[model samples]
Target: MTEHDDDRPRQPGRTVARSDPGRAMAFSDAVIAIVITVLVLDLRPPDTEPGGLLAGLLDEWPTYLAYAASYVYLAVIWLNHKAAFTRIREMDIGLQWANLGILATLALVPWPTAVIANTARTGNLADERVAVALYAIIGALLCLSWLVFFSYLARHPDLTHDHVDDDYFAHERPRALIGVLLYLAAGAAGVFIHPLVASVIFLVLPVFYGITSHGYDQGPSFLRRGAGSAKSS
Candidate 1:
């Protein structure tokens, strides 16, 4: 007996198959959870007599500030990651690995947070400089990761929805690039200025980017068309 070949409709062209979005999302969620947990480890128990509540609380202010800043920064990154992934239909192995690397760097945030908080409490310039440098380095890496992930999406337009066009890519690249530059500058400033001041300047980059995103999104039409053809297929 001879077996007949199955007849079925074939997808057009050489399309690359992608992995389950659930797996990627789960991995990201786990990484983020670990990061948040580690952040809490940076908090130190107040050192004072049981009844000296006010003094103990005052002594722990640096820790509180570090915790607050790190928490907010991580939350923002997580939100941005969620936004980027929500538009993704599928993920390639490379993209998954890139995301994992990003998460790994993010998970390391508690170290810098603790260092910075301790340095601030002790008023140690050397320790403060080291902590600030690490913080800025982490920021730069985060920006680079976003750029890498966005570039990957830009390369594989099919993985994203129709509305993600050249304009989004064009606007986003500059934003990420500027963030990288800003973080590097902040790291350099840590050599001279107080770490807290350098960190404040670094934090402003996110605010600036947020304010400019809408305007950049509405920029000249030329960027919209330049790479628009790539997604047409």
Candidate 2:
């Protein structure tokens, strides 16, 4: 028998299944939940007297800002991850590890958020610099994880749903890489500029990415006419 014939099962037209996507999804869900909880823990109680509630709360504006930014960042990642996995039907060992690494990095976000919030409140340059570096490092690693996941998906096109186009591979990779570069730049800028200013610049990334060449709307199959109509209305 030929190699193809020998590899085939005794039953006709049946292929052996490989990899389990569900497990990966479950793991992702658990990690996301934990990350959200950790973010809430970063919120600190006001230090003012009972009658000075308003002043005490106002003093925590930096903490509120940090929480808001971190929350939005996590939401964006979750949305992107969902979009990516929607097309995926299977996962290899490499993909699993990549996802795990992403979750690991996600868990670190709360610490940096807390540090930045505290430092900004106290107006400490050294602490602010350290917090910025930590946040940037996590962002960079998450970007790396995305690169790994995308590479696996590109290599194993068969794992994706039929509606998914091969061009998605080419489109998302560069966008993710550029985001990493921007985060790194923002982190480095914190050394010279105020950390709060650097963070504001970093926040511009999502807006830029949403409108730029590599945005989801720019994909080949995206319904541009429908989107335009919705916007005009």
Candidate 3:
């Protein structure tokens, strides 16, 4: 038998099955696009009764900051999602359910984002802590959903591209778990320490995950390879 990820004996009735991911991928893209659009729509121009345009804008820094950070977060998710699908050759019912779970978690991002911005804007420390805590939990759950998704993919090599090994997503699991833990920590910091600290953690997470989204040092592995080729050429 050729060496790959198929060394494991196939389970009865669980033999490899395949289906096109096109429709599902398209749906995912549409949903993610809508979420991003909604995030921006949540922003509003600051009231300008006494303050001028610049001051009004400045006063709404929390809103701008929230939008900026959330945009980057979604961008990272999109990038990683694109990478994951690129390595997936087919889809199964299990994969479809996992994907839906992930998307469901993602769809909820705008709520906490809006809460954080609105609370911070109001200068209400209690509300800010609550908002940050909510954000942290949501972020953690999203990370956990990714863990489930990856774990499912790891076990279901029949759904993966030929180039991917069984251990590929297994290795990725740790990174996802790290995200989960850090998010919980951020939430704790918000509740016990200070919301500003949690905000910093929120800003930092996307950078970490984005860089190692493919379980590598520099972003998605395939994209890095493509970039390396273009540079060498």
Best by lDDT, which number? Answer: 3
lDDT of 1 by residue, 1-233 (tens): 01221122223583566675777888898888888888898676777887997888888887887888777777777766776776666676777877887787788778888888888888778988988998899888888877787776666665655555534554466667777888888988987777777778756765654444432444346544543443354
Which pairs of residues collide in model 1?
none
> Considering every candidate listed, which one attains the maximal TM-score?
3
The digit string of per-residue lDDT tens for model 2 on 71-188 reads 8777777767777777776665666777787788777888888888878887778888878877777777777777777776776666665556755654566667877887888788
lDDT of each: 0.71, 0.71, 0.85
TM-score of each: 0.79, 0.80, 0.87
Once fitted onto the true fold, the runs of candidate 3 whose alpha carbons sit more than 4 angstroms away are 1-12, 15-17, 217-233
Report model 2's TM-score to 2 decimal places. Answer: 0.80
What's model 1's lDDT at 93?
A: 78
lDDT of 2 at 58: 88
TM-score of 1: 0.79
Model 3, 2-41: lDDT tens per residue?
Answer: 3563454444687556577887889999999999999987
Query: How far in Å is the alpha carbon of 97 misplaced in model 2?
Result: 1.2
Q: Which ten residues in a row have the lowest lDDT in candidate 1?
A: 1-10
lDDT of 3 at 189: 98
